[model samples]
Target: MGQQYLFWFAQVHDDFRIPELQSVAEIHGFDLHIPQDLDASRPFCILELDHEEHARLLARRCILIRSVCEFYARGSTYEELHERVRQQRPRWSCYIEDTSFKFIVTAYNHTIPQARQREVVESFSYMDFLGKIDMKSPEIIMTCFEEYPDKHGTTRPKDEGDGEFKEVFFGRLIEEGSARPLVKKFDVKKRLYYGNTSMEAEISLLMANQTLAAPGKLIYDPFIGTGSMAYTTAHFGALVFGSDIDGRQMRGKDKQPGIIRAASQYGVAHCIIDLCTFDVTRNPWRCGELFDAIITDPPYGVRAGAKRLGRKSRQDKEQPPTSPQNIAFRRPDDQPYIPPTKPYELSSLASDLVLLARYMLKPQGRLVFFLPTVTDEYEELDVQSMLCDGMEIVANSLQNFGSWGRRLITIRKATTEHFAPPSFEQLDNVAHIPAHKDFREKYFQGFKKSDVEQISELSDQG
Candidate 1:
């Protein structure tokens, strides 16, 4: 058995909290003994780890955590909590004689008044610490949390005095979560170069964490528009390579590409190995097992649809001219040639991405990306159908947006065995149909019904 620790998490991104914690733990080579009955709606949970260092590591890497603490006592009432503290003094009393400490009072679904907080702190005064209270910088910190009933989606003002709590937890604080600040530091709105499709800072940082981005790792982003994921991964010391079907998204009409310029903005230019332009389905790389991980946000045709090099129809596929005079000629000053492309379906792209990962990723490397889908239509099979041989899904966290949602999927290369790349014919018929097959059309359909309903009401009034 390991030491039990209390994990206090940020209130936002509830769905991603567990997956991010699991990924960080796996990256550091440890298993977290999480309680099976954990509640996602609560901001805090108790987990068991081998050492205090493991808890600190999680606080450092997990963006969703607010703090990590050494668990001491938890009870439904203050009297019960105090009694438990007296009973558990043997585990925590050693530091009371020499350490300077301060108590922090926090509530999940409500705010605690400062006056009431002081009284709550005084309630635990029987521990009889001999050291002076130091508020500026304490050698030790004590945290007390009051778990309130979930008041999510309601806007009522908090009541005066301490409201009823479902439970109270007391602990010695270990470390505050360090990764949350990176969200503000990498805010996309503050970046030098970003397009409308650029990923938000927090989500990109989460994606980077899922890839286990760290020093000396080589990460590639096939749909690297404006290099959103590239910057964060590089910030974490990973070497990044980015490519896109359209060059303009990265270059943005400048001699110095926007990807490199933004990389410089974050002082991580050296970590960006290079940026190239090519259709992912027709990529130029001839090597295999080169990348440590492939992380990307494939276009979902919302703001911009994904594209590939091909004609819209078979009849539009033209062959080179055979006759000498039949061939078209260009002058020295003629406009540059532009390749034709067609809409790349989300389902087929996902299947091909898995195939590409099988060929390009190092053994045990990861593939982390986002897939948007109609919420009601999504199923476990939709993701399972996309997995190729030697690959397995590790995490699938959803970011819901009412009628639709995007899943931040983390798939791992499970085995070192190499599998033959599927032929185009085989690729076209891979497994069950994904929920995101016609997501763009379905997403719009959700809005159309509401508009139709509004018109019907107007007609009835008329």
Candidate 2:
């Protein structure tokens, strides 16, 4: 049997925990066996890995995990736990002799007071080691975790020592997560250049993992506003190329492009090949299967609206010169000709993005992006409708924001076959009117205007 490793994950982004773990293992080419009854809502889960190196790889790459530990013993009560630890003494006894160690007591739902924390540590005195105590540095680090019931949606206050722990786990620390620091390192607030819709660091790192970004791989971001995913993907050693419909978003009043500026800020500027301005539907690429992965966060008409290259109205369409003398004069060099654009529908954009991924991504390559939807109207089948013939969904994790939520979708190109572009009828047959239709409209009107007004009135009264 493989060695069991307990993964203590950060409580944030619970839905992304398993997917990130699986992706990290897959990217490193390792076998990770997750338990059949794995509960992601809880902060801890034990996974079976072939070696300690595999656990270290997870710690080094996975952002959701806070730390990984070698599973020692676990039980619902301290008595049962002590018995298990005694039975497993042969496995851990080597560290008990001449080894400087420190113990950490932590809880999931409820905080353990300092007095109780000392008592809990004293309870483990049965394993009498003659080593000195080291809080800053230790040859061996032991951890005890108390898991209480999930209190996510509960509004009631938690009192001191009020809840009984559902379970307690004991383990020897393996490694603290190395990737968690990248979140603060690449924080958008600290970035030199960022836009209103720039993706936060944590989610961007999660998307990068979903893409399996690694050294020598090439990735593309179609809706690269301020180049959020580009930096994270590049930080993983992947070469990144990004594009946006509006050049202004990329240029950002600086002589150098904002994306490039931010990439330089993160010390990954060399990995960013170039940032271009073009409508994704009318991209400049003339080839297919050119990138290892395509990762992005497509605009859903919230903070910024999605746009495509086209005439907004018939009046803007090209008109033939009625006479030879009707020729238009060339404008001054200071003014450049700008193409007219039209609103790109969210539903159509989603289907087209899948088609683009099928065409651009290498076989077995991944396409990771976020799609926003109304919480009430969303369905599993809605996501299924946008997939192409050679592509399949790998993971779909949601980040809910009450009335509306954005789902981070990861799709993989499954086949090596070079299929023709999908026809309009084919797209029409599988298309579903997404819950995000008229999202910007409903985002304001759908939330019940009276409720908002009432809240505002209450705020004013206070």
Candidate 2 Cα outliers beyond 4 Å, as residue runs = 150-159, 313-333, 421-431, 447-462
lDDT of each: 0.87, 0.86
Per-residue lDDT of model 1, residues 385-407, tens digit only: 88888999988989999778999
Residues 1-462, candidate 2, lDDT per residue (tens digit)? 788888999979998999999999999998677778888878999988889999999999999999999999999999999899889888788987799999999898888888888999999998997799999999999999998887677676556444389999999999999999999998999999998899999999999999999999999998998889999999999999889998888889889888888899888999998889887777778788889999999988877788887656665556532332332244455776666677777877888889888888899999998989889888998899778788899899989999889999999999998855433222445346767666766676655557657767888999
TM-score, candidate 1, is 0.92
TM-score, per-candidate, Cα-based:
0.92, 0.90
Candidate 2 collision pairs: none
- Where does candidate 1 clash, by residue pair? none
What range of 10 consecutive residues in model 2 has the weakest lDDT sum?
320-329
Those runs of model 1 whose alpha carbons end farther than 4 Å from true positions after fitting are 153-157, 314-334, 422-431, 447-462
